[model samples]
Target: MFANIIILILVLLALIFSISKWRIHPFIALILSAIVLGTTLGLGGESTISVVLQGFSETLKWIAVIIILGAFIGEVLRETGGAFRISNRIVKWVGEKKLPWAMGFTGYIVSIPVFVDVAYILLQPVVESLSFKSKRPVLYLGLSLAAGLTVAHTLIPPTPGPLAVASLLGVEMGRMLIINLIVATFAMIGGILWVIFFLKNSWIDYDKKLQDIYKEEQTTTHNELPKGNWLLDIMPIIVPIVLISTGSFVTDNLSGWVGDALGFMSIPLIAVYIGAFIAVFQIAKKDKKNKVNRLVEQAITKSALVIMITGAGGALGFVIKASGIQNEIVQIFSDFPFLGAMLPFVVAAILTTATGSITVSLVGTASMLGPIIDNFPMSPEIVAAIIGCGAFCVFHVNSSFFWLLNRLHEVPPKVLYKTFTAQSLIMGLSGLIGVLILVLFGV
Candidate 1:
């Protein structure tokens, strides 16, 4: 038992150091962690190999499809100017006084179906436009938007990170979605308030180049498209969520004819695909080219990269389980009085901080803590929330989102650390506090 515990600790630490400090890709780092975990727990080579392959295959089957379809949808929205149109209308509705809040909300909604990077790129031009018009700092506006997108991408469902964590813990997606919305709303509010209270004091002088572009909007090579209907643009994204939530509600309560009918209609994945396809074709028809096909191809390519990285992380989790390392760690935690309940959050935070990938943190957390929860009588909701909350803590250099803010928004390192990084830390810590309070009350 002592040897096993030591081995688990060493392997986990190594995994953290190698990934964060060494700049190793998560896929490679995860595989190495799996190998070390398997060997430490005395799993036979053949069994370890089988577990790794099976885990990758099983996880990819479900995740790959959703990601691919979602990516295609995102690409289609981007190419057709749907995202830009929607954002512009939102800015107009909210007016300049609440522009930060409006931009944050736009990031939150758009990120549900779009990749974070693509979402940022799609929306950057809009923020730039806003800055030019208002003569305000683009950094504040961009950071507010980044905060919204980051929170949703990491904490919300239908995105791969939280979805994978929910699946690994055997929690329902609908429940996860509901909880995610609650947590994410708080996080976004925190970010928006930060922008209003703190960033408003700082003045951002507009660049000469941006001023030139703003003046020549009509003659510029890229002209803004006519504003599209906000309802039309938003409906495609919301349909799947509404259908899934309604289905889950019916199946949970009614459980009769009504429930059966709703179940038949609830098919979320199908709804999403159908919605996306319609949007793609509609945009293509209006434009008179095969833009839809090109967007689909781009989405697929992007989705492949995300799928492979996530699958590799899943394989690491499976290897840990098969090798008995997870069980051993669970045993160690169970022997402690208060540690079992807290272990999930602690380890998840550590992994997330080290790896800088919430997906990897989720995989690692579920692997180490899922069996622990199974050994206890804790509520799965609480456990799921704990995992989700834990994954949010400590957004630093290891995280891609960190570099994204620095590079894309041109936020100085000090400002990035102060605003974007601090926002993530606050969001994560607040989530954990919320979960802890619930756990205390036996919720």
Candidate 2:
């Protein structure tokens, strides 16, 4: 058992090294690590191969369609000017003095369907505009935006990171959403407030190049298609959540075919599928059928890589289970009661800090720890929150989001370390605190 633990540790290190230092694609590294783990741990060739295939297919079966639907919705929103419309109206409603708060909430909404980097890209102009109008430091609003995106990216479903983590941990989407939203609120508010207080009087300069690009973006914005109505724009985001949650809660209240029908309608796949068509309807209302067709194609194309990577992460997870190492660790953790609560968080933080990718961090840590963690006494929601918070903490040099924010303005990396990094750390810890509070209440 001790020997198996050492093997597990070594393979994990190798996996990290391959991604961080060797630049191996994560899909490839994960697959290779699974085989190596199964082989060294006495599963032998055939058994390991079976476990690999089993893991990949099983994991994908649960989430592949949901992911595709999610990607489809995100693509439609991106192409249809839906996200822009939502945020634009938000900007008007909140007005200038509240721009930081507005940008933060806009980020929280837009990023639910959109990737964090892509959300940042879609909203950057608005964030910049908000900062200028409000007369606030760029770092202030920028960090607020980052804060929202980071929280949703790590904690919310259908944005990939938390979605995949939820599936790997055997968590239902409804439960994940309910618990994570509460925890994410804590994170988002903490980040927004930190930046609000800290950078209130600070002045930061953008690089000349970024400043010129900003000026260019404002004047030459696209005008080819109509933006979705800000009111109708949120349908795609809300439909799935309402359906899934209703399915979770209402199935118990109603019985017979009616209940079953509602349950079927609420299943994530059907709900998201319906949401995609709602997105199509949005495009149809604009008389852009051709655009509608193209968006579906784009969603199919884009979801392919995410699906493959998620499947590979699953394969590695299954192989870890097959190796007996997971059981070994579970027993060891049994002796250290607190390990149950903190292990997932620590694993996630280490991987995110190492790889600079929250998706990878969430996937890798969840895949490895999910099965073993079932042996722990923590609730699934608490585990998910812990992982989400861990993934957000220590957002320093290794992260792409850090660099994205750095390039947004002329803020030196050193200064960002003090500002943006500091904000993420506070938000992450706040999330952890929120989870502990839930645990105290016996959630």
- Give lDDT per model, in order: 0.72, 0.81
Q: How far is 26's C-alpha from truth in model 2 (Å)?
A: 1.1
The collision pairs in model 1 are: none
Tens-digit lDDT track of model 1 for 1-443: 67877887788788788878888777887777777677668787777778878878866766677777777777767876777766777777897788888888888888888878779888877877777677667777887887678777777656777666765666777766766676677767776777777776444334445776677443321235654666777766777677665677777787788888777656546656766766665474564556766777888888776777778777777776676655666666667756766777788889888888777787778765654557644676667676767777777777777787666655666766777667767767666666655556655
Report the lDDT of model 1 for residue 18: 86
- How well is each residue in 1-443 modelled by candidate 2, as lDDT tens digits? 78889989999999998988888988999999999999999999999999999999998885888877887788877876888787777766886678777778888887877778878887776666556545567777788888888898889877778878888888877877888988999989889889878889767656334454455335323232274476777898888878876688888899999999989988877888887877776665565877877777887787787788888899999998877677788878788878788888888888877788888888898899877767877877678889999998788877888888777676789988999888878988999888888889888
Off by over 4 Å in 1: 203-223, 253-258, 264-268, 286-289, 335-338, 375-378, 433-443
Please report the candidate that would top TM-score against the real structure: 2
RMSD of each: 3.1, 2.7
- Superpose all Cα atoms of candidate 2 onto the true structure and report the RMSD in Å to 1 decimal: 2.7
What's the lDDT for residue 39 in model 1?
A: 65
Off by over 4 Å in 2: 207-227, 284-287
